[model samples]
Target: MDGADYLHPGSEWAKEPDDIDSIDFSPTVTIMYFADDDTWQAVWGGREQLGEFEGTREEAIAWARERCNTIRIYSPSEGDIVDLVPDE
Candidate 1:
């Protein structure tokens, strides 16, 4: 396999695949608030338990940035989700 294969599976022999960044999927990081626990949960890879945090969203973002490329904060009260990763 060629070096390009690592980036796009089989681009060396087959058609080059679409960019992974353009693919629409679930977020890599999520900051969720629990009313019962009154704590913020930093979820990684949609399922992996990264651990929990306390205080403002800024703190959570800082914590998540160290581990993930894209981060999302979900507000249960507002019932909305915010994406922290900027557009490329």
Candidate 2:
């Protein structure tokens, strides 16, 4: 299946299983900030937290489109949707 196949209804986007598996489990939305510098902050979610990840922004958008939903990427200016990645 493609990235679109994994999107959940009403959600902004979904990631392929490969990508989702890479993200560190968190209780909340992972937050990343960009200013003079870039910083990333992760929020852990409860066991009930449900979501997925994409390998790229385009994939994420496609997932969103498949679900008829819109995603807002977290940014300092207006926020931007981005594919979640695992921390090194």
Candidate 3:
């Protein structure tokens, strides 16, 4: 896929109260995508973990665009790293 095909949406992820407790915030959105060779993966997550996805790079990008403020594209070899931190 062409790099230009990648699209990112703003404010796709937001800090919201949990369903169990409206006063508590524990929700987030995460999206993961794999490279063309399947050897690499890109994962994107929100402040919590409300939404999550794991698949090809295309799928991850699509998922993030649909449910994340920013899509972090990286290789699976990078390990599980925190791309962003929540603000208090």
Number of clashes in every candidate structure? 0, 10, 6
lDDT of 1 at 9: 36
Q: Identify the candidate with maximal TM-score.
A: 1
Give the clashing residue pairs of candidate 3, or none: 28-49, 28-50, 30-51, 34-56, 34-57, 41-76
- For candidate 2, give the lDDT of residue 8: 44
Question: What tens digits encode model 2's per-residue C-alpha lDDT throughout 5-86?
Answer: 3234334544335566666444444433333233333322334534554334455444434432223344333234354443
Which ten contiguous residues of candidate 3 have the minimum total lDDT? 4-13
lDDT of each: 0.58, 0.39, 0.42
Q: How close is every model to the real structure, measured as TM-score?
A: 0.48, 0.28, 0.36
The local distance difference test score of model 3 is 0.42
Task: Write candidate 3's Cα lDDT for 1-88 as tens digits.
Answer: 6322233322222223356453423333333333465532333333444545556656655655666554444324543323433330
Clashing pairs in 2: 15-53, 26-44, 26-45, 27-44, 27-45, 28-44, 28-45, 73-80, 73-81, 75-79
Worst 10 residues of 2 by lDDT: 35-44
Q: After superposition, how far is residue 35 of candidate 1 from its true place, in Å?
A: 1.1
Candidate number with the higher TM-score (2 or 3)? 3
